[model samples]
Target: MSVIWKGVFPAVTTKFNDNDEMDFAAFDKNIEAQLEAGAKGIIIGGSLGEASVLSDTEKIELLKQTVKTVNKRAYVILNIAEQTTKAALLCAENALKYGADGLMMLPPLRYLADKHETLEYFAAVAKSTPLPIMIYNNPYDYKIEVTLDMFEELSKYENIQAVKESTRDVSNVTRMINKFGDRFKLMTGVDTLALESIFMGAHGWVAGLVDAFPRETVAIFNLAKQGRHEEALKIYRWFLPVLELDIHPKLVQYIKLAETQTGLGTENVRAPRLPLVGEERTRILAIIDNAIANRPELPAGSWGVEA
Candidate 1:
């Protein structure tokens, strides 16, 4: 069964209650909103979702809940960010057991594995599971660049289907296409570069800000895909500032605040990751308020295409 990996797949934040436990009520509500807004899929336990702080059990339960709530309406991809090969394989097995539709995996965390080590780790995990995988290539955050040559070697694995292109270099989009052609599907992982990536033939987006502004995010992708560049630009220009929030260190706090302001979710993040406060909070709120007050009218009728 080929999973159609395309369009906006929000790297959704894991909602927690005041006691630092998973808040299913808020979580389910958020998932419903994403589906209603025409999100192609929902990704849980990603960097945006705070995967590092979550325990293994919490990660599995989150994947299970997402799979049940989404109920085949869209893809539910679990992020595999582990320290060792054994742990990564365990996460992959658990994801398959809990009915995850696919996975988005980062290379060895914190160790900065070299190219050969990275390739070996990925190949081992790919062989261990039958689920489709999207190799995340974000050197800016991970410090490990899965170079084009590394991809050439890993392309032999049939389950390694796509890449989350977060290199921050827009030109890499073209470079990947030039080298691999249609061998690997490219999905823009950076929220700010989404429109440019789509215009450059990227098939999808692993979005961050869409957790709060789903309709606008989907609109930009659809409009550009339909060749409506002027209309897409109008929305993209308005969205750039809000999208910048996703790339920051406090993205979890900032995006959750946006969700609360928009009436979609809450601002209760886990400990050590407190809610945005002080002047920083005021500054972000100002941006969200300005965008909301002057929100652009979306094009009439459905703006999304089926994957």
Candidate 2:
């Protein structure tokens, strides 16, 4: 239970060339944009970063580059979820070697579970690194869920500092906070539920939308932290459309498109994960454009989408 592992950690998308190799320059630029925009940390090689598609060497290089570029301004978290414990250990060791601030891991996929196996999966990964660990509890993405009872047990780990709680159920969040309030730091991963989670006493947001709208993310969290409910609601209303887009599996495509359209990061991504096209592309672009046009008071690129 370390307290250092809390706040708005955006899972940064890894940039790539058309040939599908790691594009270090673009990746660094993306990290810089996020740090400058007020992200508490950069989550390199998470789902948003297409970690599954990345080669082992690419993941190592990306972590190395992230450490070099971030220069310690924010906490650095690396996502190391694989189908095997040995694979997770190897990746976790690599991240720790590069001086990462923490590690986030999901349960081993493809296993039909018993509670015993689930506990083993996490304990094995936690044993791999001394760095603070954030259990990435996204049942929708990983299909392996960690129950609250599981949380009570896992919180006993000296290194298991926080839970990246992506379950959109506010009641579940409330229960976790009420039960494990003093034990684990609960960070919301669902952007649409972020303000609510904070107000409910959850620690912070591990946000995807923060890459596109860091200022708004900061404003929402800051106002809520100060008990300014009405002001926070105002910012949340303006940012809701963009925030709601993150509810989809195609979040990477929409956020990247918004980035390119507004000059935050390149829209290019690795293979096996193609860019948005046709109706998807058109709809995302239009919404971003309309939002920017309506908020002329917010500068060009202030919102990280085209005006």
Q: Could you give candidate 2's per-residue lDDT for residues 1-307 as a string of tens digits?
A: 2336555678777777777777788777767777766667788778888887888988888888888899988888888868787898898889888878888888886775567788888898787678888888878766767999888788768898888888777777788878877678888889898888888887778888777666667667766776777777887888889888788878888888776766667777776568888887898999878766664233323333211
Residue pairs that clash (backbone atoms under 3 angstroms), model 1: none
Q: Over the stretch 163-222, how does candidate 1's per-residue lDDT look in tens digits?
A: 999999999999999999999999999998999999999999999889988888888888
lDDT of 1 at 272: 78
Question: Deviation in angstroms for 220 in model 2?
Answer: 1.3
Per-model tally of clashing residue pairs: 0, 0
Each model's C-alpha lDDT?
A: 0.90, 0.77
> In model 1, what is the error at residue 25, expressed in angstroms?
0.9
Best by TM-score: 1
In model 1, which range of ten residues has the least summed lDDT? Answer: 298-307
Candidate 2 segments whose C-alpha is farther than 4 A from its true place: 1-3, 296-307
